[model samples]
Target: MTNPTPGQTVSGTITVAANATDNVAVSSVQFLLDGQPLGNPVTAAPYAASLNTTTSTNGAHTLSAKATDPSGNVGSAAGIAVTVQNPTPPMTCFVLQTSVTARGTGTVQTGAFSTVISGEVLLAFVSMDGPGGAAGQSATVSGAGLTWRLVGRANSRSGDAEIWTATASTVLHNVTARSAPAKGGYAQDLTVVAFEGATGTGAVSTGGAASGAPTLTVTTTAATSLVLAVGHDWDKAVARTLPTGFAMLDQCVDTAHGDTSWSEYTNQATGPAGTPVKIGATAPTSDQWNMAAVELLNSGS
Candidate 1:
């Protein structure tokens, strides 16, 4: 006999196989569950039966096989003890806004904060305000003991700013922002936004040409999970797309130059996990672009 070994746990439909022999000639073989007949006896070699494990109680059960010879002599194999287990429940993950900050800076600036929730991953977004539109300027944001790459940037009349982000598993993070050399101007303003309880990983890519669309791609290790794409550029419209098995959670636009407008677009969808997410956008005014992608591993911890 093979399968459903003693003390093994099983669920759903299971297969049981066995072989029997007799001196006179084996006529039939019968299978039993918990000492009761499983079904009609099998009358051939290589005996096998499909047992619906869901129909059995969620506990220990005994399985045995009986064989009968041409002379009507009967023999039974020792019972195998197995356990039936219930189905596992689905996992859930929560997204929460942790903190926000606004600071003035031309050089490197850092913002230190602690997470309010326990066992929560961290994501921080840093937007830098530049004078002559953030077109020729660049900003870098770092936190959670790791440095974040630029995801997207825009330089419109409404504002001249760039957005950067990073993720970490630590509860406390020190976010820093730095801008490239610029003409003598007013102190640039840096805005910081933090997200909690999200599993995030990201990468950065550069544009090949000076006036064409740049494509950024980031892949995750989780087989299935939530994903986010971030794109940045100067004086260009940005858009993002998830992989086949992933859906968008929420998207927000922030302008840090002049008006500092913030808008959110929320729509949920599902896509494949453990795949790469790609974001493509046009950058007409500047040659540089930064992109980041994050995936949430909601595997019940």
Candidate 2:
């Protein structure tokens, strides 16, 4: 074949062409791939056929053509070898590596869990019952071999909800959440989750709530990202349902003080997702609650 010359690497759609001349008169020209008919014979000149390489396996392929004479005599051209090379798809990066939850009086800490991937982002959601506000009622988070930063906080008349983040390496460790003492002794629930493939701690879209639905609308800053939504409720006896299209990571309750804490995540693609990412939950009772949401970017996003 003249086009897609021997040893050429082809991808997507390309034209296959051949030159043929007969003593009598060439009635038609037929194209073949690997000795099989490629399509209906061509009745016009410039003997050529269009081929979509994606339909064939990504490997070596052979191209040839046949010309038919009025007398029924057919002549075959020598086959040319070519390689099909299509682009490989990218692999999914956002994945949950580990999760832990703790609840009780005084300082609450989750059990140690091993992180399987390096450069994973660690998240902590703490809900405590006591005086409500950001003053001395908020919770603080820490871990070994990691540095934690407060992303956002929400407060209710009966309790306070806080979110913290840390960039972590592969290690075995637990997270601690201690409520400030000035809150007059409190009971708290803490949930810590680790996710691999996140490049670093991203920006918080929105946070803080007094009561009612714990939802937030945010536009992402990265093409591929991991969006997280978390909520804390005054009714510790009930479990909060995650918003639609989100996967649950962890949820816990501090039964002693009647407070609940939970977290969920969704992986976004080919975006700076422009949709309203809400952590809309189904709460059984119309009680005091707080919610927060953050967007974490992926590597090379």
- Largest lDDT belongs to which candidate? 2
Q: Which ten residues in a row have the lowest lDDT in candidate 1?
A: 258-267
Off by over 4 Å in 2: 1-88, 132-136, 169-184, 206-210, 253-255, 267-273
**How well does each candidate superpose onto the true structure, as a TM-score?**
0.40, 0.61
- Compared with the true structure, all predictions reach lDDT values of 0.50, 0.68
| Model 2, span 142-240: residue lDDT tens | 764677888987664456677788887644433343333236467776777777557765557545445566666656776676677666676555777
lDDT of 1 by residue, 1-301 (tens): 5445577666666666566877778899899998899988989755767788888889889999999998889999999998887562243434444445444545545455444333454443333334433254445555456566555554432133444556544434334434442433433444444444345533332222334444445464554444444333433333333334433333333344322212111123224554665544432324343333444454332
Residue 206, model 1: Cα distance from true site in angstroms: 5.3
In candidate 2, how many Å is residue 154 off?
A: 1.6
